[model samples]
Target chain A: MSDKSITRRDFLVKTAQGASLAVTGGLLWAYLVRQEAKAQPYALRPPGALAEMDFNAACIKCGQCVNACPPDILKLAPAGANLPIGTPYFEPRTGACIMCPDIPCLIACPTGALAPELKDINKARMGLAVIDIENCLSWKGLRCEVCHRDCPLKGKAITLETDPRGLSKHAVFRPMVNSDYCTGCGICEKACPTEVAAIRILPPALVQGKIGDHYRLGWTFDTEITQDFKPSEQAPPAPETSGGKPAGMDYLNDGGGL
Target chain B: MNTPADLSHSKLVSRPLGARLWSWRYVVLRRLSQFGILLLFFGTAHWAWEWPAKTPLLTGNLSASELFGRIPMADPFAVLQIFLSGHVLQQKVILGAAIVLGFYLLVGGRVFCAWACPVNMVTDLAGWLRARLPIPAMFVVSRNIRYFVLAASLVLSALTGLAAFEWVSPVGMMHREIIFGLGAGAMALTAIFLFDLLILKNGWCGHLCPLGGFWSLVGRTALVRVRFDKTTCTHCGECARVCPEPQVLNLKRLEETGFVTSGECSNCGRCSPLCPEGSLAFDLRPLIRKHGAEGSISSVRRTK
Candidate 1:
């Protein structure tokens, strides 16, 4: 501690030092939490919470939503406990969001952390429910419609899709989630009768897979509109890997059969 | 060898527990307010009667509350973070924050730190224990650091798109963890206590907490302030001894301006009761001139 008064230079230096230190610390913190941000670890946010990035910014960690929840399902993440401290999350395995008619939690959120416009709880996209085909009893040739039965949106969100293979003696009812209708309420996940629940709600970030933009689906382009849609009379080129089209394809014969 | 101020202070300290408790009236009130608020939260969370499991009276947590589904109470700092982070400020949140801000404007802002914040009780306990223990002052922290801390948190919130400090705020941590049994946040609370007890006395609240700093800004224009009656004063210096922010009660500053104008004052009334000459009093007056803001200004009130 210096006895001399702080010169203008001293103040400037300290400010610069402090600012730099803080910036570095903040960036480091954001980076450390980036992985956690990507995967919410089955932590279900209250209805209408913006996507993970926006919600983190918007939520003040007020815990008002937790109080508003009648089922006592909502709980704020403890400091240094996963999913960013003070942000509310629920484990579906414990107790799922009941999709209350009035949606009390959204009304309770002071910050638009929970989207105020989301008056309909059915529209909540907390996560996407995906049925594990390998572990699902219905997929294993057993009659298990537990998930499909308990879905809040029922017919719209979770519907039975029959197997095209037609190997079963009886009808195969495989529960499939329609992403458009599934609110990711986790009701189906909660209701699954399997030892390890077959249907699980996964955060949107994890479940939504992307295909490379370069790999265009050829059929998507209208054949009527494309100038290059000339029906070729000549033989097709040899395959690049195999050097020639031998057993698999004789383009002329295939075209004639089609 | 002790001065007359020390003699009176020692006498006050030496008095029986009952007499001393009566003497410190405001302290008792503040403690009761802090502890009472905490108990309400604890009871609502953990101890409601099952049979009479009617709607709980107080249902909210530390960051915000709604009483009887009508009254909306919020922590101004927490709400402000949301706004600063580019969140749409809903009408209810705005009104709730305004109500809190308005209350602080009347009573003085640092009143929250003294009367409501559970963390203050912990730090105050640490301060009390430090007084009795033979602890040596380890270092000095400039109180201006709080303003910097406030600035940094605001910047971080804007940049990171989060209520940045709420992630680690010991105040929120203690409130939540105290009820939930401090699973992971125990270390943070323990560190704060130890920091106050051993390192810099009043380190966290006095020098570091951005929330306290924010309230101090709100406290600047507050109507209630400490007024020094210079005419009746002996230069006993007892007011400075117990004062949390001793710089607020600087003799030269008081002589120049009759009121302690720094919003940093918690209005804890620790100085007033400790004053041997009864020169210090909490008064309601217009803050025409804040001595801390403009240096060496003459007293606005009539000088004795």
Candidate 2:
């Protein structure tokens, strides 16, 4: 066999080969992967996570969060799984974030993907729990308050409001989600008893509505005061005096038309 | 066909575990560590499953471990991800990475490939089975492909904004499969094994694994290395046959430099134990003095 040595020439040749491979691989990823990619609704992130984009960029894909989860709801996305791989996520219906007091997942994070400043777990907005009123047992008039009962924030985040349309004798108590206090922990979503849960966690991106900039209620505007308070000049002229005034009115006299 | 004295002398040298214990000492140590590390991760998993609430064992996975009540150790690649991602790098993480990096620099970086990576052990089993079976390597890939893979993975990470390889890495996958029982991780590990066993010999570790490639780069100036003695060598060629990265072994180069200077060399000590003439051995060197004419010569003699 020839005694092959890695000369400088060979090193350059290998480097060229490696560079070519890298270029081709990168191009392939750009063309094939980016072209066909679909946006996955953001998974339920651990408490203290940055915004979706920041979290995706910051997370190192270590399973520290999964290990720290006492209830074991957190799982690192597996390779080729529906979600992007290695980031921590949990399916609400399968299991929900238990909202640990210390927020152990945040503490366990080596990167600030889950920010340490998120000392209050209640501040976490992982996703919004939107109730499908049509499918809700309570909406169908069977008395179910599972979501309101199971909510981590209890009465603040979720409250049972009597269905206004229900008969007085048989009031349907519908569970309403108050976005202000809801942390989106998904406990209510997970605890829903329906085959298809009436309350489901929707990623913040999906459920949070964008306010239209153009909308301003007339009462809220200061323009009301600036405008003339008097009746407009264009107001219709007073109807001509009726041709048939009563005879008694004609006699009454003088000075004016009533 | 040999006489009783010849048989005894041959048996003494090739005792496998008795007289030549030191020859295989590192290999034994590596195996013990590999198995022990695996057990440490899996034992907690098993205990966690049985108890579900109060596990007696420590909490961690293979990617990052906090063993013995807060002695943190992290994967360097994982740390690299944190550094590149613009995240707030925690003090504990940097300390852990430094500790691990220091260990590999002092020993050899590729020691992780040979001793700690669970995927390496699985591939070894597959390679062993293939050697015994009527299997032929489908193709040969340049060992340098891993460097390209490493580069491309980093590029992809930059584009995608995450540590992309960690998601699919068979090393982390196999570990997860064992501890977390992820079905997808199991599938990924199986696919890697099949690709390594059937597609190319040592394909994953030698040609495709970015982590191993990164470590090889880190190990370029490693203190611990395989020393080759030219005077005692009979040119038997057994070492090359057993070597996982045979490209690192150039007989003429060994004759010239008296040591394996290839960064790709794992310093696994396979060649040392298999060298019929005991011409190769492990040696420690200071970084600054490496490759001096007198230095190499003295190290070779010391090994003898």
Tens digits of per-residue lDDT for model 1, A1-258? 567577777989988998897778767755554443444455679899987778876776667677668887888877666666667888786788889989988987876789888978888899999889999998887888888888888888989888766454776778788998988878887888888888888887787887866664557675443636678899887555344443445545567346
Provide the clash count, candidate 2.
0
lDDT of 2 by residue, B27-92 (tens): 787788888887777776455532334432444565676655466677877767646655566676
In the range A10-34, model 2's lDDT, one tens digit per residue, is 8799789867866887777645433
- In every candidate, what fraction of the native interface contacts is reproduced? 0.58, 0.46
Clashes of each: 1, 0
Worst 10 residues of 1 chain B by lDDT: B295-304
TM-score of each: 0.82, 0.79
- lDDT accuracy of residue B148 in candidate 2: 70
For candidate 2, the per-residue lDDT at B128 reads 70
Report the lDDT tens digits of candidate 1 across residue range B105-220.
Answer: 88889989998888888888888898889999998878888887788777766766666666567888888776544556678777888999999898888899999999999998
